[model samples]
Target: MTSPHDALFQWTFSQREHALGLLKAALPRPVVAAVRWSTLRIEKGSFVDRALRSRHSDLVLSARMGAGRIYFYVIVEHQRDVEALMVFRMGLYMMRLWERITRDRPRLTELPPIMPVLIHHSDTGWTAARAFQDIVAARGPERAALLPHIPCFELLLVDVSAGRAGDVVEEALTALGKVVLWCLSVSGDDARLEREIGHVAAALDEVLRAPSGLAALEALLRYLLATHERLSVQKIGGILEKAVGPQAQEAIVTELDEIERRGRAQGRVQGRVQGRAQTLLEVLTARFGSVPAEVSARILAADEATLVTCTTRVLTAPTPQEVLGDDGPRVSPARRPPARKRARRT
Candidate 1:
């Protein structure tokens, strides 16, 4: 079975060059030219472990700019959903890179800047770092406050659900975006989204055959189809067949099928465990008003049989106190716990 980490690694490495081209287009002219002047190295695995400990980042690109006098690092983290830890993780990576560079080149006068870019397909609004208080305080109270300003991370948020069929390159990016959004969307009518996604997929098929775009498109499509649960290999393959050719479509389908089989097996095991835990928690909450944090944690960590038994007890228990063994409330099963006390904590 291919782990999420493995899948992510494959996805990132596959599109490393294509993503680099996109980044180059977005960078300042001098920086882009200077960076291009020197060799751009794609470093993966333990090389970047000090910066990003996990394999979640799709690509890490580093190059020497300014006549090979300075080193610039760009870390691209890709995701189908919003992760709260992204900010902290990027901050950690930046700090680690700085430390390593300084330690390695102690005599250097200055270090190059680091840019963290998030390529996300979430429909949820994206937010960057807040600088209101910091900016205001920098000039207001203590002129010497001297707090280092937080670096601004760029967010390339493309929500496919908001786009329509258009230019090939734009459509390709949108289609990739939609494929991700489709995977993450869990509510309402998905028919429209699916239809649009198919259109994008068809466009991607043609892009994959083009000499200039073929490699990148194939890599991106492979990654999207493999990691996203919403995209089936058959659907994507059909699109590829229409866009590219049967031979390429067959190869992609085979790879996707293997990935899906592994993912499904793992998902089934996880789902069973999660379902039982949820059932236990629901039952406990019903009978005992609200499950305490410690109790909930215990439930989550409990074995499957234990959770199943707890669920059974919850269904049969008449009152809150019965399930909790006399320590809980004596309220009816439908009665909820106190508003303030029952609120869930992270």
Candidate 2:
């Protein structure tokens, strides 16, 4: 199963403020100073290659400069593995974005500039080429001569693996950025997750003070419960209670109960619909080689949609932890971006 990191990473950036803050912090200081963060806007309905949607997940955010004539495209890459042809893929996506701009403004003659930023979170650090030209095969002077024809753009790479947990969480400009980077850093390591709960909880309290903080807190709690297997609902809720307040703890417990209720209710219907359950069990058995009783029991009880999601993830997920998506306290909210009204358009 694919790691839930993709979904969680996308969710964190879906917030306009979080996206802006992360870009400012992750980019160079000089670059950050030049842009008008106030004008930054996430360009919705701007993705392409619909048929290859499962290949990757990306975010396209735009901000204007110089009387709105110049714009910047911040394309975020959140894949786990490094793609050597990333430059080519970025080039293709940029071309599609430019085409989209021209279609929207037929009178324009020049396309706005775009800065591609790749947010990589692999266990191993990124060793791939940063510039598109690096991937091109040409020898000696031929490479220099062809430089004019080849794309020379350099993508800003934010390697999550290359930072200390303390520095990243403490220094991140946005609360959401801190939360995400911290989680990503400790994703596969339950020991680190437990050790750093105090720090994470402290940062979360700061995030919880704002008006929209509760929803963000809820999302974070859900993300933790889904991804961290060693964390129990009581354990997580206790950490949150100590860090935030009893209110937060109670909310988390309530959500946990709801998820369990839904899962079991779906289980009954699944038992009656033997065909889909059988298919799911077969897939699980093939991958895990005799699924554990508890896990098999869950499959027998899960709804068709959850089974489908698990099946899709099982194809690439390395462990039952990933296929189940959440092995801790609760199931994740439906596999979709959190629904909220768009912020004011730039």
Candidate 3:
């Protein structure tokens, strides 16, 4: 089953206009207005594949709003959690894209500039670039360097747990953020949250009703619900009611329930597998004083057949040594080695 987070990630990039709107809302006014946004399709054989294997970016935007000006490129990468290698990955993508453009257009004057954007939802502090020198300095020498200064990408992080919904949206988007805050604040018991949910749901419904927005809205809802596990059907229904209307709430509820059911099923399967692995470890530890780290890891990684065999051995072994084979010392043998004695200090 596809996770909600995965669905949101997909939704963010699936529609060019939706992605453009998000960028316009998040970035500075001058930059947003100056760019005419559109999606960029990266084929399998393209240079983008050298750096990234994925078919689509979280969002790929092109800016062409300026008159008689070269259109710039922006690639937005969204991540639900913190990724340690994010900077390195972005660097690779930047490098590959730059190389491709340069190859296609030999003249430096002919190449258009590109920008990378990273959108993350994590509490931990993260930076898009590790070293300032990578952005400022050229690879070999100061004067003869091919590319001296590549504009470092921007990092837009949303920490859902840190603040109120209004604050979060405000920090990201002044107007729409308020809408998000209103939708999130609607409480089940409190009539205010319920009303707010209805309002937001109506707006969302209007957007989704449009042929272009339908797919995008579906993707966004899936992502939001998946990422925010605490979100309930009532809360979602409220939002849908406001965005899409009361009539669409039923369909939304059904979809949310289906998603929840799938998530629970996946969690249960994982729990069972982990439980069995832990049980096997405990049984081994009880039979043997301490199992070797490598052996224990192997046991944990073992299939059902291996686990059953080891479990049987654990129950039937007469002594700890028998359970662990020759690697372990005999516990009850009469010919056991004498305990080493410490020498008296002079």
Find the candidate with the highest lDDT and give its number.
2
Summarize candidate 3's per-residue lDDT along 70-102 as a digit string, tens digits: 322333233323555555566666667667667
**Model 1 pairs whose backbones collide:** 287-320
Indicate the residue-level lDDT of 307 in model 2: 77
- Rank candidates, TM-score, best first: 2, 1, 3
lDDT of 2 by residue, 233-279 (tens): 66766656676655555555665676667778888765666677678
Pitting candidate 1 against candidate 3, the one with the higher TM-score is: 1
Candidate 1 lDDT over 1-346, as tens digits, reads 4434334334543454544544454455555666753366665532345344343444456766654433334433334345655555555666677777788789878766665544433445344432223323356566445444444454333223234112113422333333333333322223543444454455455444455344444555555454545756666555445644665465566655666787799899778988888877776776667677766777787777766666666666665334434455556667856567565889
TM-score of each: 0.49, 0.66, 0.46
Instruction: Tell me the whole-model lDDT of each prediction, alpha carbons only.
Output: 0.51, 0.69, 0.49
The Cα error of candidate 3 at residue 315, in Å, is: 43
After superposition, candidate 3 runs with Cα above 4 Å error: 1-6, 36-57, 65-85, 108-110, 124-202, 208-244, 250-346
Q: Give the distance in Å from residue 144's predicted Cα in candidate 1 to where it truly belongs.
A: 9.9
Error of 3 at 59 (Å): 3.2
TM-score of 3: 0.46
